[model samples]
Target: MSAQPESVTTPARSWFDSEDAPGRRDLETCIHCGLCLTACPTYRELKIEPDSPRGRLYLMRGLNEGRIAPSDPLVEHLDNCLGCRACETVCPAGVPYGRLLEETRGQLDRRRATRETPMRALGRWTLRHVVPRRERMHVIADLLRLGQWSPIAALMRSDWARRLLPPFAIQGFAMTPPLEPRDARSLERVAPRLPAGARMEATEAALVFLPAGTAKTRVWFFTSCVMEVMFPRVNHEAVRLLVLAGCRVEVPRAQTCCGALHAHAGLRREARVLARTNVAAFADAGYDFVVHDSAGCGATLRECGHLLDDGPDAERAARFAAITRDLSQVLAAVGLPDAPASLRSPRDPSRPLRVAYHDPCHLAHGQGVRAEPRALLRRLPGADVVDLANADWCCGSAGVYNLTHPVMADAQLEKKLDTVERAAPDVVVASNPGCLLHMRRGAAARGLDVRMAHIAEVLGEAYPAPEMARAPAR
Candidate 1:
């Protein structure tokens, strides 16, 4: 990110010198188009240009040309952006807004390296230290899970607790779904997890799964770090569904976190390290595709080409990115073997399972994956995929955006929940973890009966996973 050993010549007057810096030509392509205005969640909420993609591009261009200097207001304006990439989706000129913004952030982080706010400092530490380490992340999750049921959780829920710690901390605690047991959440337990007729064989370094019949294709399952700890049920379902579709599913043992959170937070150095690790982990694994269920992680994995677009690893990164696909994309291509047929509305057996699918911004906007998920949802034996107003619109759960910019996050969340309530579906499904957790919290706070779930969970309902080995009773 520092561009210390760069190969390209830096512009004489430019403030950004990194190889990854926002390219001048990329900024000039914006055309000052307002087409992205309504699509932008922050601009829609604040009605300001600096907060919009066009305005931000102008600011980036100004800095790249040395027309302006780094300042607090500039960082605030850039920081307000959710980086959901909705702007890119609507831009006719095809401006890579997310990439440019990330590069610009890297430049600013260097300038303000010594001036991190308490909140920002904490975020940087967590992204750098905790997220990339599998064991540490699991430990933290286990602790949080314990706290969720303790008397302290009730105390934290009280109004007076806001005075003791950051409001975001309390809000995040309230938003977390109940954590699965640590024993059940382990990768060893999760990878071998299968449905009723499926079987698996464990090699020294990986687990190979065989479907109920002959395997159709080979896939390397990337179990996202957060998904495993927070939503292991969904991970199990993803593998179960994959095997059921007649694929030889392999779970690589050496893979690390996808680094989407790091890259989004502008910790590019850490992001690059994690990216290279993954590229090496799956090298020569012999798979038709590297598939994952979490949309955000899928976007990051696919963008490894750009994240590592320098040094000797560039070509390999490109190769890795090429084969990476979201869970829905692979399933859509391979097709589901059968729909469970028992997944119907509880209130009326004759009615199809009333469902609404909310598109995660990363899936819809980041990876250009919109239809695949919906198509899979439609294939459910009794499903009626309802029309969600602005289904592609972000649910204000843009990674850690809910914690970093809670006010704006809530503004967008309220509007999203409003639409969900209007649709009045029995359940709402999203592919990414953050959106599911955030929207689930909002639905519960409002006492809405609507259940928020991952697409895999709903898919699992249609095609259930294998029975689990029961944990001993206390």
Candidate 2:
């Protein structure tokens, strides 16, 4: 394939003019230590300076100085970056690489009216129209589910599948049952609630169960757009485990897509519009807290406030963001009251299942939620949590990077898969949907049997027998 075409627009006067204040500050903070170069997956894979964070920073500087146009090969190198922000973790100057990269990408999108190719256009169209629209995505997801059982599914088992229908095949393999529709009364009845005195005396509650008007204390679970349609079991188990932990859970009807896909893809206007809709949807839910299972959604929701320009909507966005928490962080803070008694002595006492935890770049580098998920995993009976080498390295699944930069993404993913395989773990647990999806595809491509699961699903397996009820709230 031809190299992506060079930019037609004139380069901005300076990085200062090209970027927002935060971007300029981050770019200025770069000490050029090259520490980030080693941690960057693309840099390591290609062994090219330009693919590294330091090299990309220089490119950004050049773009800002009008030394290179927005469509230059240098800019394309910047575009190929995974944006995993693993570089920021080790940056001695504490440069805000994540914010800087995002700002730069957003600015580039703004200046360029059209994409370079048809595939990019099609990808963006699907993400904006099909993925965000729950109905359309669900329809496609159902077809994928059926396809998994058909003879053509064997076609999906080949290397050609990776080249032909990569995204769909990946989704097909990770398929889980769709969420069960919940009514208002069932939500309240099944939700975990604080004891009357507990509610009155406590300064905080675990979560404000926002089941679409149902009284279930379990919560209003935001299964996420992709997780709901593709990997419902993760969200289902998350809800089941939370309810068992004495947290009321509800799946709020008002809860919608988290808009991370759109935001990351540079559809800022669409992202903000969705953010505003979500703000209004949950505005009066009267829940003490909002919990999300997917780390990607959790992080995006937490930053929804940033999506809005200055206005009342911006203030509301901030408020909504504050209440959202990741499932592991929330459960660890609150403590699970009714954890399975059997878990007191884990299942495989003789040889506790050796498991490796791949830290999703979003969870580790984006939200600083590194320890909580690990802590929760360690609590599982007979489970040995092994840390892979370079635990903070990106898995090359920075949102849709695998689709947009498949060659670079595959090289990075291959390295990650090698690390995990060498550890010889019985399973691999990752917190974010993107990580799980990307890792699973990589593992399958290599014919590896490392099981991939969300932290919530793993915890759910430990819930005591006589699974929790789904009663309507009184």
Candidate 3:
């Protein structure tokens, strides 16, 4: 036989044994226009072609076509992605970059099931076991909360102690919100009071909450696992706002984590399991919409269809994804009662409370939510709503990306905090729990003297209920 070309000398052996492998259509959709380069956080940070979305697409295509084998360098390039999906927003060809990336990671994860590093193994285990379990997460939070109150927290804050700790450890410690007591964290305290003669079938169950007045919209509230423990008040305020908006909201007992963190970490089966659980939980709830306050959870909920497309719940998942709405989207659509006279800067009632809005990456790029949050903030009476520069940029809390890749995460965070300082708002609102945690810590480390809040908290401030303001504090 004549000498074969070098390209044809070896057989192309497939390595992606996972069913969710990134396919040709999504990979080939990238035009290599490089528009996504500037939009991607890693590419912008590294200024490297491989770290860019287009370059990553090429790598994914190579893996899919069996032209390249998974190696440490190749996996590192893929692992470095924040998975913020900012590239999807700017893509002209409408490549499903987020979906493709998740699927590609799924393939890699399956291949490395046996050869995983200790750190990666620990992360995967936690996502599989703990994150999907609400009670265990809260218990861990309680332990961490105890640590936060102990002298250890103060010691950790010291320059010497900080220097001793790894950057990720310090960052993780900084991101920990003051955990709430179970009582304060409970959604039961604020479940709406239904009127004398009115009741709904969904509210007949243990997890459902009712609105005081006529229900304008029926919704199932997805209390995110992270939001439940780290920022419970956001959930409370959000549920309160939903009630006040005439939403008969139900907190389903069966609903679990949205699986964004799981998917980002490449636990595809775990993500699907959680997706299936949610789809099943909300199936008979009879809600007009599935409302979520956390942007990360909201994005994951909106993608449940794609996540479960190959599974038995494919049709149900598609139906579930259709009704998912962000809290801001729902609030804007329904219109809140006027911001009360009490909603003003504590420093001086004469001056408007300056509020700045930071866009959460998943909400903006993942779900295309930008204007609604700004508009909702602007509508607050006596508040000066300000715009954040490059608001839609990822805040580097990309599903634990800050913990895994602290260097790039801190770089992105510094830039974000710089913008907040320039804006100098009394409060900067980011609608995702992860963004709230990450940026809040970043702002404090910079000594920026700013408050980080969820949009629900800001709006809840405006429309205070008897439940939130309870007797002593106010």
Best by lDDT: 1
Give the local distance difference test score of model 3.
0.82
Predicted candidate 2 versus true structure: per-residue lDDT over 101-153, tens digit per residue:
66666666666723567766776788778877877876776666666675757
Tens digits of lDDT, candidate 3, 1-474: 899987787767556765887777778988889999999999988899889999888888888778888888888888889888999999999999988888888877876733477678778888888989998998888888887986979887789987887666776777897788877777775644222333333444446666656778888888899888888778877877877777777888888899998888788888898999999988974678899988888998999998889878999899899999999999888777776645566567778888888889899998999999889888888889887899888888888998988888889999899888899888888899888888988887788878888888878877766554552111
Q: Is candidate 1 or candidate 3 better by TM-score?
A: 1
Please, what is the TM-score per model?
Answer: 0.93, 0.80, 0.93
- How many pairs of residues collide in each model? 1, 36, 0
lDDT per residue, candidate 1, 1-474, as tens digits?
A: 565543346544877776578877898998876999888988988899999889888889988988787788888889899889999999999999998988888777756632578988898899888988889988999899888887989888887898887988998898887888888875456444565567888888888787876778999999999998898878877888888888888888889999998888887778889999999988874689999999999999998999888778988889899999999989999988777545677568788778998989989999999888888888788888999999988888899999988888888898999999999998898989999989988888888888887888788777644452232110
Best by TM-score: 1
Name model 1 segments beyond 4 Å from true.
1-12, 113-115, 187-197, 348-350, 466-474
Q: Candidate 2, 187: how far from true, in Å?
A: 9.7
Q: Order the candidate numbers by TM-score, best to worst.
A: 1, 3, 2
